[model samples]
Target: MVDSLAKMVGSLQKDVDKSSRYAFQSDYALFIDQLFYASSASHITYTSLLATKLGIDLSLNRLVCLLYIKDREGMPLADSRLLYALIRTIRTRMTNKNQDIVGLLGTSRIVYCPYAETDFFSREKLENQLQALAATLANTYPVIVSVSVGLYAQHVLEYGQSLRSIPAVVQQNTSNKSGSIIFAEDHLVDYLLQIIPKSVLDHFLGYAVHYLQENPVVYETLQALVCNDMDIYSTATQLQVHRNTVIFRINQIKEVLSLNPLHQDSDRFKVILIYTYARTHLNKEI
Candidate 1:
C-alpha cells in the first residue's frame, strides 16, 4: 500500500508540474488547490504506514505534524533523492535511539520539490499542508515531533537566508527560535529592509524610538556619539557642549534604554548598533 501510494503521489506531482506550464493566471488558484489535494492525499498514505507499523488503527483525518531540520550554509536539499536520504537519516536516528516509528506518523517531515521553475503548486499551499500534517501527527504519534518540511522554492530559500543574516541576539530573543527555519511575514521583511541601512536597528530601534519620544535632546547627543569616534571628550567638543552635558545625556540614555554604557558590553554594542542603523537606514535629519 505504501509503495502504491508513493508511486501515485509521484505521478500526481509530475502531472501538477506539467499542468502548471499551460495554466493561465486565472487558473492558478485551481492549480494550487489541486496541489494541496495531492499533498494531503500523499500524507494520508504515510499516515497509514505509521498506523500499520504501530499496530493501531486510528482514524486520523488531517496532517498537522511538522519537523524542521536546521539547514545551515543554505545547502539546497530539494531533490527527492536527497530528501529521501534525509528522511532515512531521521528514521535511523530515531530507531537507533530506540524511539518508536509508529509515534512519528503525523509528526513526519514532507519533502517537496522547490517552487522555483515549477508550475504545478504554490509554496503557501505546501506550507498549509505541513501545518495540517503536523496536527495529524500530534494525534497519531502521541508525542510531539518537530516535522521539518522542505520546499523547493527559491523565494523560501532566499527568505531563509536573509532571516539567518539577522543577528543571533534577535533570533534568541524572538518567538520563532525552536524551529530551524525562520518563517517571516511580508511585513516583517519590509520592516527589516526599512531598517537595513541602519546597522543594529533591530537591536535598538524600539528603545531609541521610545527614549527619543520622551527626551528629544538625547537624539542630538546620540547622533554626536555615533557619528564621532568612541571618544567621549571629542564627541562633547564636536557637539560644542560641555563634557559634563555629554556625560549627563549619555547617562540619561542609559537609564531610559536600560543600558549601562560603563559595565555592559552587550548594551553598549546594542546602542552603537541602533545608532548606526538609524544613521544609515533612516537618514533622519539630526
Candidate 2:
C-alpha cells in the first residue's frame, strides 16, 4: 500500500508539471500577440518553409500587410475581430524577430516583413508599387494601402498615424471615390484635409447638434463651403444656388452657432469638424 500511494503521488506530480508547461506556452503566445499590434516582432523556422510552399514572395527586410477586406452589406469592411484572428494565424507562420513590427488602425494592419542583408526596393519605388497594387486590390476589395519609409523601427510608428488619416484624405481629395492606397510622405496635406477621427468629431459636434437640427440648411451650406475651401461663389455654383443665397445661409449659420464658419479662423475649423461629423453620422438621420 505504501509503494502504491507513492506511485500515485508521482503520477499526479507529472500531470501537474505537464499542465504548467502547457500554461506557460499559452501565456507566452498571448504576449507575442500583444507585441504584434503594439506595432512591433520573433522566432519560427517555419516562415521560410511556409513561404516556399505558398509561393508568396515573402521578404525579411520589408513586408507590408496591405490589408484587403471586401465590403459586407455595402459598408467599409471593419470586422476587426475576424481579421485579427486571421493575422494571428498568419503570424504563427512567421519567423520574424523582435525588430519586426505590426500596427493596427481601424480595419487595417501594417506588418513589417524582415529578413537578413537584403535591401528591398527604394522608398519611392516601393510607394509606386504599393499604389499600383492598391488600385488592383480595390477591384475586388475595399482596400486602403498605407506605407511608410525609413527603417522598420521608425516606419511602424508613422505607418500607424498614416493609416488613420490617409483613407479619409484620399477619399476627400480624389475622384475615384472608392478605397485607395496612399504613401504617408505624399499626403502630408492631411492637416489641411480636416482628417478628424469619427469618434472625436462626433463628441465635439454633439454640443451644437440642436442648432444644426433646427437649421438644416446651415449644415448643407456649411458642407459646401468647406469642401470648396470656404469660397462662397464656388459653394454657390456647386449648390446651384445664387451666391447671395450662399452668403445668406452663412450669416444665418453664424447667428445660430454664434460664430461665422466662413470668416473666422476658429470657426473654420469648427465648421470642418461639423461637416465631417455630419457626413459620417447625421446624414443617416436625414
Candidate 3:
C-alpha cells in the first residue's frame, strides 16, 4: 500500500509538470510572435522552428497590420474584455480563420499573413478589407481604431521593420485622422523624404495640399488618381464615384496647384512628389 501511494503521488507530480511545460511553451510562442513583429533578422530560424513546432508556417512571404484601439476621446481601452473582443473580431474578420496568424502586441492586435498574394489578405485586397473592417469595428465596438498596414517590402525581414514604422507613419501620414487605414513606410528612403523642406513643399504644392485637406472628396480623388497611375477610371472605380467626378476633382487639383499629375514633365514631378509629401506629412500646413 505504501509503495502504491508513492507511485500515485509521482504520477500526479509528473502530470503537473507536463501541464506546466505545455503552458510555458504556449506563452513562449506568443512572445515570439510579438517579437517578430519588430524583427529585423533575415529569417528568424528559432522563430520559424518554434512556429513549426506549434504547427505555424513562417516560410512564406509575410505582411503585418497593427490595430491600435482607443476610446472616442482617444484613450486606450482599459477594459480587458474589450481588448480581447477587439482582437478576436479583427482576427476573425481580417484573417482566414484557419490560416492567418494573429497575435497580441502590447495593447495592439497584430494580424500576420505568412501567405503572400492570398485573395483576402494580398497587397491589393488588404486596404479595402481594412477599411471595411475599421467601419465594422467603429459601428460594433463604439471605439475609434486606427489601422497600420505594412506589406511593401523586399525581404521577409523588412516586414518586421515595416511593423515598427506604424507609429511614425501614423503621425506623419494621416495627421491622426481616426479610422484611417494607413500604409506603413516600407523603406528607409522615407528618412530623406521627411527632411524635404516644409518651405519647398509649400512653395510647390502647399495651396493644393491645404485645399485638399479641407476638401476630403477631391483630396481622395487626387489620392486615388496618383496611386492608380493617373487613371481616371481607376480612381473613379476605387472611390465608387462617377468617372466625371474624378475628372472634375483632377481638374480642381490642377487648378489649385497649377501643376498636373497627368503631365509627364517637371510640373508632374512637383505635383506628385509635393502632394504626396504634404498629404502624408504630420502637419497639413507649413
Per-residue lDDT of model 2, residues 88-176, tens digit only: 64355444444343333334443434333445546655555445544554553444333333223223233334345445444444433
Please estimate how well model 3 matches the true structure, expressed as its whole-model Cα lDDT: 0.61
Top TM-score hit: 3
Rank ordering of all candidates by lDDT, starting from the highest = 3, 2, 1
Candidate 1 lDDT tens digits, 108-214:
23422222223434547655544554444334332232333322223212322332333322332333223223233312433354545444554538557656645
What residue pairs clash in candidate 2, if any at all?
39-102, 40-101, 40-102, 41-97, 42-96, 42-97, 60-114, 60-115, 61-115, 63-113
For all candidates in order, the CA lDDT equals: 0.44, 0.50, 0.61
Alpha carbon deviation, residue 83, candidate 1 (Å)? 41
Candidate 1: residue 232 Cα off by (Å): 0.6
Q: What ranking of all candidate models by TM-score puts the best one first? A: 3, 2, 1
- Which stretches of model 3 miss by more than 4 angstroms? 1-43, 108-114, 118-124, 152-156, 173-178, 185-286
Evaluated with lDDT, which candidate comes out highest?
3
lDDT of 3 by residue, 1-286 (tens): 9997567546643443343323444634443453354232322443444455566555555566777777887776676678777767767674555445566566545354435544334555767777777788788986877777765433435556656566556564543445677665442334335555777766755666667778877767767776787887888899998988887877777777676777657666555665566556745543
Among residues 3 or more apart in sequence or in different chains, the pairs in candidate 3 whose N, CA or C atoms overlap within 3 Å are none
